[model samples]
Target: MIRAFANPHRFMALSRWLAPACLGVGALLMVWSVWQGLWVVPHDDYQGGDIMRAMFVHVPSAWLAMASYMGLAATGLIWFVWRHELADMAAKSIAPLGAAYTAMCLATGSIWGKPTWGTWWLWDDARMMSVLVMFFLFLGYMALRAAMETRQKAARAGAILAMVGAVNVPLIKFSVDIWSSIHQDASVLRLDGPAMPPVYLTPLLIGGLAHMIFFAGLTMMLMRAEVWGRRGDVLIARKLSGA
Candidate 1:
């Protein structure tokens, strides 16, 4: 199934409708979850009154930030092994989007943390630091690609960096567990199942799903634009050569 969409034309065809469908559904789900989170759900005094609502947005961004980097690495690996041009395009597209989500994660985490943790940032916290490092990895991947003079070189450089940087993802996930940290341990994704009740967990899960679907749609749209831009470049080159 993955190989079937390796052809640019097939990908374009599939993504045209699929992208919008995902975007629309994701938007609706986002609205529903946000509405439920902000108003419908009751607050727990344990986590933080009213402020816990930010989890609707923050948790999803954190999830996406990690997920997107993994996506970048997976695509980079695909391009490296199969020499798939679309995979390279995907990695390129995912970098900026992943960075955006990572930024959102950091910003929201800080905002949620300031009142809860009594500080704006925690440099010593392993989870926080690991995520910060992932954010830099996203930025570094883009910067490294831009530093290269040619697309082939850019892709090769970006792929290597992305794959290597993927190791940090696990570190981010297990940071709180492996080291002493102020951050809370796994609640939703745990061996003993989610610690949250359905009222809170439902919206959080929905919000996460919404972001992932929305990100996927955005990726397809960006890849589509890249495909058209590459085609235009090819045409321009042909015209200049009088082909």
Candidate 2:
């Protein structure tokens, strides 16, 4: 099945239909979740009233920041082992989106921290450092890919870097527990289950799904663009060579 759809034409056909559907669903869910979170959900007991509402966007963006890197790393693995151009293109295309999400995570986290933690920044926290590392990894991957002259060489190098940098993903997830940090401990994925009430949780889950769908849609669109552009370059080169 993977081999069958590895062809650029087949992938483009699938993405055309799938991308629009995901975009529509994602937009609807985002609207509904934002509305519910801002109005229907009760304010937090400790933090300033209504300020905790940022969680709807912040948490989901953070989830996407990490998830996008994982997706990129997996695509890198496929590209490295299978020598699939489509997979390589997809990984390259997702780097910017992943970096954007990571930046959003840091920005929103700082905003949330200001009111809740009484400070906008902290250096000693392992989780914070891990997030920063994630951001740097994304930047490094993009820079290294762009630095190489040939596409093949760049892809190979980028894939190796992406796979290596993925080690930080696990570190980011467990950093709060692994070391003392100012950041709050895990709440959503704890063994004991969610700490928040259902009212807040309902909107959070909805927002998270919305972000995932959005990421998928965006990634597909970028992948399609990369595929088309690369094919065009190949054809141009072939024609010029024949001439």
Candidate of highest lDDT: 1
After superposition, the stretches of candidate 1 with alpha carbons farther than 4 Å from their true spots are 168-194
Q: Weakest 10 consecutive residues, lDDT, candidate 2?
A: 185-194
TM-scores for all predictions: 0.90, 0.88
Candidate 1 residue lDDT tens string, 48-144: 6788898999999989998899899999999998989999999999999999999999999888777667677866566567778888999899999
For candidate 2, the TM-score is 0.88
After aligning candidate 2 to the native by TM-score, how far in Å is the CA of 176 from where it should be?
7.4
Model 2 over residues 103-221: C-alpha lDDT tens digits? 99999888877766667876555656677888999999999999999999999999999888886567665864465444454322121243677888889999999999988998888
Top model by TM-score, which number?
Answer: 1
Candidate 2 regions exceeding 4 Å error are 168-194, 238-243
lDDT score for residue 126 of model 2: 60
